[model samples]
Target: MSTPLKTLFDLTGRTALVTGGSRGLGLTMAEALGEFGAKVILTARKQDELDAAVAHLAGLGIEAIAIAADMGKPDEPARVVEAIQAAGQSVDILVNNAGTSWGSKTEEMPLDGWNKLLAVNLTGPFLLAQAVGRAFMLPNCWGRIINIASVEGLLGHHPRMIGTIAYNASKGGLINFTRALAAEWGAQGICVNAIAPGYFPSKLTGYVLDKHGEELRGDTPRGQLGCDDDLKGATLLLASNAGAHITGQTVVVDGGASII
Candidate 1:
């Protein structure tokens, strides 16, 4: 019998690990997964933030577990996988949303800033995906890996926009990372994909938006910034079985910003 369309999207009995899920985009994605019945594990650098995120999910009747692990740190990504294993749960969906950004002129940007951005934005996702795939997904032969790239990955920074060479570089690399990983893992029933979002109101973009909100809106073909709910459907589509046949693709959710 064919599975119903509704059944294809059901995530019951699965587990999702969302890095930097304590707030903002990460939290929003986590909520979508949990709402569809996946047990969620939220990880970030701050315990308090994780706790609050868990509380917020609970308020929505979505039970979630929290882990305070910084994705930027060298050892934290593997440790997150280990901790979840110790809890007797395997990650079926891995959302690499924990990241940092630095804005500066190319010549003036310090090496440290560039390194930090790559470490979190590119390296962290690679490590988490590797760990989860090796520890669980590869062995189980089924999983979803969502790397949260950005429109910055797809286009050059506008002259009026802030300088963010390293941010753009890392995100651009991530889009290819998604393609490469998917090609390698697709035969194993692992679907690797990316979501390249445009500017949305979040802690990560608060300052950028404050400085160039109107300019950004003007550039977007939609003539508006992304809303809080903009990412929910994209996240769900890629995270659930509804996206079973989709792999090695980048879903640009920039409200037509990248088009113009």
Candidate 2:
């Protein structure tokens, strides 16, 4: 028989490690996981931001802790995993939400900017997944990896809209990474997926919103961008038993923008 609805979604004993969880989409997903009963471990570069996020979760009665680490650093992923292990916990869910973007015309985009975007948006997630999977998930024979991709990955951005070629390329690579990793890990009980968010008003996209919010919203069939809670349901589904059979998929949380 199938598990009960509530039971399937219950994450009572699970633990989640969310990179970039101090703010924006990372915090949104972390909040969802914590509210649903997962003990959340958030990692970000700034200690103050991490502390604030932990306190916010605490106000909601969610058990959460924070570890300050720069995902772009080569050694930081291993360091984060080691710290978690030292805490006597293994991550059941890994959210690769730590990322950055660089905007410039394709012809004028600096090599350094491209490299930075790729390092944080693509390479960092790959390193974290490898370390966390080897240390915790693969050994335990169960895991969930959710990569935060962007709609720019799926569709090219118009020059008039925003020229972010490097960011788009990185996210596109991340989507395929999700598929490839899922294929390799599925039999071992690890499910990998990506969330392709359209345009959310967060610290990362505040400038874009301020500049072209109306035009972007008009482009969407729903006539709006994603809100703070837009990702909650999809995140819960993939992180819980409700998504056990789902893998190697990019769940787009855009307000029908991709479709229209």
Candidate 3:
């Protein structure tokens, strides 16, 4: 008889692609996946950063590789997929963690800025999924797609200081896309889900945290910014066997902030 612990959450033979895997939230989720025994391929624009993150994962006894590609580019996703396929590896999991945000008054935001945000935050994931999903997932009859979204997708940002209309819209669209993909692919044994984080000390929030760390923490029910470990369980639960039956769900990792 197999133990619950043995069968649940086991990712021993899985392969993953984590875009924006060089730092912050991306790296955190990549590390968690590695810890659960998945071979992780990290991709980002900066080769130096990807190299560093690959080295760090190696130190943890995880087999990781760095692929330097700008997922934001229109053609780069196919190139990155080709690189992975050339290595004779099939993607079993994809963490669409590459994203960007620009903050400015909606009226002041340039059209280019809006388009850029959608390219990285929304289009990139869709293209990557379409490429990888068709090549590997649909053929093998199994896969996982985890998009890293944000709480701002669920609710509007503070009117007094909120400035990123494009970011908010992209995230909202991402959530809906996750649900739609999950619904369509469930029969094919592919699970598509999202994780909406809140107030993490990532590069995107460094400026805000630097300026108002104390004030922000005070407002949060948890009284502290989200830590790296905070993302591990949820991600693993969604990516591994533990979540085989769960699909198209957005698992919010915020510390009760949305509840309050």
Q: How does each model score on TM-score?
A: 0.98, 0.98, 0.97
Q: Which predicted model would earn the best lDDT?
A: 2
Instruction: Encode model 1's per-residue lDDT on 1-260: one tens digit a residue.
Output: 88898898999999999998999999999999999999999999999999999999999988799989888888888898899989988899999999889989999999999999999999999999999999999999999999999989988998776799999999999999999999999999999999999999988898999999998898889899988789999999999889999999999999898876
Candidate 1 at 22: error in angstroms? 0.5
Each model's total of backbone clashes: 0, 0, 0
At residue 54, what lDDT does model 1 achieve? 97
Question: Of the candidates numbered 2 and 3, which has the greater TM-score value?
Answer: 2
Question: What is the alpha-carbon lDDT of model 2 when measured against the actual structure?
Answer: 0.94
Order of the predicted models by TM-score, top scorer first = 2, 1, 3
Spell out the clash pairs found in candidate 2: none
lDDT of 2 by residue, 134-240 (tens): 99999999999999998899997877866899999999999999999999999999999999999999888988999999999999999999999999999999999
